[model samples]
Structures are given as structure tokens and as C-alpha cells.
Target: MSTFHLKIIAYDKIFYDDEAASVVLPAIDGEVQILTNHEECVVALKTGEVRIGTPKGEMIPAVCGSGFAEVTSDNQVEILVDTIERPEEIDIRRAKEAKERAEERLLQHKSRMEYYRNTTSLARAMARLKEANKYRH
Candidate 1:
């Protein structure tokens, strides 16, 4: 069976380290699935979900921040992200509060820099909320 070693590092933490049959990344262009022996390349990721396909065929979802990834020629993938949050690790209440704060900031008249900062924060909070709620049902 073909498999690849994957390591995801974010915010000074080892988010995930293991071997997987496949992994889907939220690249800037779109989602990209990497399989064993996938062509070596690098990509920029956005604020979205990173799906890992375990050997047991289970798909684990993780919310990740903007960053970049590199797939080595030896079938190893390394992803360096600004932040990462597992659905179970997210504090919904706190995320909601952050979302509210970001929304309020957006509503206020601000300089271009402030607006962009708030917008980024809002996007990050929303991404966390979305991942946390996905499995609620």
C-alpha cells in the first residue's frame, strides 16, 4: 500500500505527524489532494479545512490558517501554518465572542490597515466556527 509521511506544524506546535494514504489541503487555488508519491511541489494554503485520510479510511478535518506547504520528493509532506485548530479543540463560545468583536470592528469606520486586519480576524474566527460546527450534527 502506498502511503506518505505528513507533518503539519502551526503556531509552534506539532499539529499532526503520521503516515496517511492521502491528504487534502485548502490551497489558494482550491483544494488539492496529495497521494503517495505525489509530485514534489509547494503551495500556499488559505483559511480552510485540511482533511487527512487515515490508513483506516477515516477522514479527519482540521481548521488551518494561511501558510505554505512543501511536498518533498521522498513522499513526505510538511505544512507550516499560522494556526491550526481541531474541531474538538475549538471553544465555540470563545470563537463566537471573537467573531462578535471582529464584526463590531468591521462596522466601525477605520483606516485601510485596520479594516484589513479586522477582516482577517473575522475570517479566521469564522473558519474556526465552521469547523467546530461541522460535526455537531
Candidate 2:
């Protein structure tokens, strides 16, 4: 299969940089798959799972926070997200605690911005937990 340059950058570090056969992203509208020579465009991402298909046919999975992806005309794909972590890297206990905190915050009610923030936090925590459990040994 053909491949393209895929670079995934989290706020703290570069999560991935190499040739990829494909990538399935959690776009705002829905899951978007990008293969080699995919159309040049940009898409908003939500807190969810990211599946990266490597040139060697391995599928690397990750959970990512909200952000965006840009596909350049040169067949290069770049994903910039607030956070990204592999299932093995996720701490289930920490994610569960974050979810509980977000739920508590939501129950208190606050400004619209605060509510939105809490909801996003909850979503990210849930995504992380789900991915981690799915791949748990």
C-alpha cells in the first residue's frame, strides 16, 4: 500500500512522525479516514480515538483531545491536538478520577464556558479510559 508523511503533534510533544499507510481521525463531523494522496483539506477533531495504520501494517491506536488536522497538497498530513496518548500510556485510575471531577463540576452549574469546558474534559477522560480498557492486557 502507498504511504504518506504523517506527523502528529500534541501540545507537549511530537507524538508521531513517519510514513503512514493511513489514519482514521475523530473529526467533528465523524470519523475521517485519510489514505495516501488524500484530498488536501483541514478538519476539526474532537476528543476520541485516533487509529494510525503504519507502513508495516501495524495499527497504532491513540486517544486525543480536541484539535485539528491539516492535509497539505504534498501528501503530508499534520495533526495538532491538545493531548494525545496511547492506550498503554493512559492511567485508568487517573482518567476515572478526572471523569468524576468533571461530573461533579457539571452538577454545580456555572458559566457557559465552564460548562463547555467540563463537558469536554469529561469526554476526553471517557475516551482515554475506554481506549485503555479496550487494549488492556
Candidate 3:
């Protein structure tokens, strides 16, 4: 069995740090899975779920804002995002409110920059809501 050092960090805190067997990240193109000794490269992440597989084969689920990840040649994966929230940590009511607020702002016909900001907010909010509700069913 093989593994890699994985670190997930955000502005406020470190979400995770340990050795993992694999990780699945949400990329703009699509979901990407990185295994131990995977290719060394940088990947841009989107507002979606991040799945981590530990050495013991336990799966962890989380959601994060748009960010980037760097994979070192020596089997080190570092993910830096603005914010990361585990499913259990997310406030579903707050996320729903955020989604509604972003939707309302989009309808106001703001400037281009404002539109982009609202759009990003909506995406992030939706992502969080989806993650929070995933285990409910």
C-alpha cells in the first residue's frame, strides 16, 4: 500500500493534515482523483465536494470555496482554499439564506463585477447546501 501527505488549509484554519490513499477534488473541467505518487501538477478547484480517502480507507467529505491545489513530485498534496467546511459543520439555514440573497442580488441588474460576485456567491452557497444535505437522505 502507498500513501501521500495531504494538507487542506484555509484562511482561518487547517481542515485536514495526514496521509491519504486518494483524494477526489472538484476541478473546473470535472472531478479529479489523485492517488499516491500521482503526477505533479497544479489544479484549480471549483465550488464543489472534496472527497478524501485515508490510509485506513475511511472516506471524508467536505466542501470548499474556489481555490487551487499543488501536488509535489514527492507525493505531497497541498490544497489552499478561502474557506472549507465539513458537512457536519455547515449551517444549512445560513446557506439557504445566502443562496436566496445571492439570487435576489442577481435579479437587481447590477454592474458586471457585481453580477460576477453574486454568481460566485450563488455557486458557493448552492455547493454548501448540497454538501450539508448529502448525508440526510
Residue-level lDDT tens digits of model 1 in 1-137 = 67999999998799889999999999999999999999999999999899999988998899999999999999899999999978999999999999999999999969999999998899989999999999666
How does candidate 3 score on lDDT? 0.94
For model 2, what is the error of residue 86's alpha carbon versus the real structure, in angstroms, after optimal superposition? Answer: 0.4
lDDT of 2 at 114: 99
Better candidate by lDDT, 1 or 2: 2
Candidate 3's residue-wise lDDT over 1-137, tens digit each? 79999999999999999999999999989999999989999999988999999988899999999999999999999999988988999889999999999999999998999999999999999999999999565
The residue-by-residue lDDT of candidate 2 on 25-104, one tens digit each, is 99999999999999999999999999999999999999999999999989999999999999999988999999999999
RMSD of candidate 1 to the truth, in angstroms, is 1.2
What do the candidate models score in CA lDDT, each in turn? 0.93, 0.97, 0.94
- Index of the highest-lDDT prediction: 2
Q: Which ten residues in a row have the lowest lDDT in candidate 3?
A: 128-137
User: How does model 2 fare in lDDT?
Assistant: 0.97
- TM-score for all predictions? 0.94, 0.98, 0.97
- Best-fitting candidate, measured by TM-score? 2
List per-candidate RMSD values in Å.
Answer: 1.2, 0.6, 0.8
The per-residue C-alpha lDDT of model 2 at residue 45 equals: 98
